[model samples]
Target: MKYTREILSDVEGYVPGEQPKSPDVIKLNTNENPYPPSPKVIEAVQALPPSALRKYPDPLAVELRRACAARYGYDGEDWVIAGNGMDELLALAVRTFVDPGDAVLTTYPTYTLYETLVRLHGGRVVSVELDGAFQLAEAFYSTPARLCFLPRPNAPSGVCVPRAAVERLCAEFGGIVVIDEAYVDFAEVDGEAPPHCMDFPRRFENAIVMRTFSKSFSLAGARLGVAVARPEVIAEFLKTKDSYNLNAFTQAAGLAAFDDYAYMEANAATIRATRARLTNALRDMGFDVPASQSNFVLARWNGVPSARQIFRALKERAIFVRYFDAPRLDTALRISIGTDEEIDALLEALRAILG
Candidate 1:
């Protein structure tokens, strides 16, 4: 009586962070921007005419694509593509590059969605484990596969791999290399320049850098994402995208957010400052916290009041943080950087729970 494919039945699918409905809860699990989106975005959405919704949106999302290109230093719109979210674009990458039964590689303890997408596409998933410190292992560079998903400022751990190491992977890997820079906006920059792989698309034909408006731009609800690569590679990706993948409202909101890019930067700076305070506070409390370059930190508790106990205790108090039962992460709790007041509340909660 089962109508689905065997692969679909066997897959466990990706589990996203918990989304609590109550307004009383202090939510710090999903890593959403604690501040509101740019005022320009709000105005743009409100300004959308009723007529705009009467017809189909631009399938290519040209205006939004152009803005992204200019912002990221890409040559033109042809080098970029927009999607419902980075998740949709990621699905497109798997469909475009991986044939059934083909090998798709990724680093373990990375984003689980990558593995889920590859599995849904009937591709073999080859996972190379990150070392003890969450750095890329040598095997990640040499692994043979049709496609590789490398998330800089890697999820759960929030550690970033260096640009030189990324360049080496692109130069040597035989297949496509996707640098998932979902959290790159929060990483420390070098002077005026950001330390990211946005420029890789121009230098490496096989390199594609993907960005999301969810984290930095505060447009997660709008579901906007952009992919940058060589025009030839983008051309192939365009063929696989769904018709009118981006709606009129999302396009307008994303473009407006880009217009006020400074707003996003200022918010990111605030999050970075808060991240430092959160890390230090956890360390002072005897938690093993690795320095995070993203909007969240993984706090590993080694002694009394185990991570699981802390998570459940916090939930009972209506303060939520992320907890993973997976290997290497079992002892840790991933906490998102919330508002200063929210963080203060979490710290106060931890102190009470530990004592």
Candidate 2:
């Protein structure tokens, strides 16, 4: 009676953070931008003509792609490919590059979706466990695989892999490397230039850098994402994408947001400030917090009130943060940087719960 492939029964799909229904709840599980998107984005969406919906959108999303390319200093639109979201582009990479039973590399305790996508495509996942500090293990370099999904400012941990390390991986790893830069916008920098791998696509043909509008651009609902690579690599991605993958409204909104890139920068600055404060506060409260470079922090609680108890207690109070039950993460709670007031409320709740 089962019509699906045998693999379907064994696969447990990626579980996203809880999205609460009530408006009053201080939802911080998902790493969404707490502030609104650029005003230009709102204006652009509103300005879309009703007739625009009557026809198909641009199959390649050229305008949006060009804008993204220009922003990143890419030579032309051929180097950029837009998608429904980063997730779609990720799936495309797997579909275009992987054959059934191929080995796909990913870091342990990283984004769970990477493993799910590889398994669903019948690819084997070779997960290299990160070091105690959450840095890439030495095995990551020598591991033989057809593709590698590495997130800069990695999810859950928010620790960015060193730029030199990435360069080494690209130079040595024989297969394609997809550097998922989903939270690169929030990465704190000591130097004038921000740390990023955007230039890798130009220097290394096997490197593909992916970005999402969901976290920094505040366009999660619009489902816009972009992939940057050598034109040859992008050509294969373009072949796999759906015709008209990006609708008219999303294209307009993403373009407007990209044009006003300063708006996103300003918002990112605010989140970084809030993240510092939250990190210090959590540390003061006895949680072992790593110096996070993303919009969220993973706080490991080792004291009287266990992380699970704190998560359950916070849930009862309608304040939500992320708690992973996986190994090395079981003792930690990942908290997204919310508004100043929202963070204040959370701190107050933790004080009450711990006492």
Per-residue accuracy of model 2 over 1-355 as CA lDDT, tens digit each: 2999988888898899988889999988999888899999999999988887998888888988998899999878999999999999999999999999999999988999999999999999999999989899999998999999999998899999989999999999989999999999999678334599999999998999999999999999899899999999999988998888899999999999998999999998889989999999999999999888899999998777789999999999999999999999889999999999999999999999998
**CA lDDT, candidate 2, residue 16:** 90
Model 1, 140-228: lDDT tens digits are: 88889999999998998999898999999999998999999999999985534359999898899999999999999999899999999
The 0-to-1 C-alpha lDDT of every candidate, in the order given, reads: 0.93, 0.92
TM-score per candidate: 0.98, 0.99
Output the lDDT of residue 45, model 1: 94
Q: Please estimate how well model 2 matches the true structure, expressed as its whole-model Cα lDDT.
A: 0.92
Runs in model 2 deviating more than 4 A are 191-193
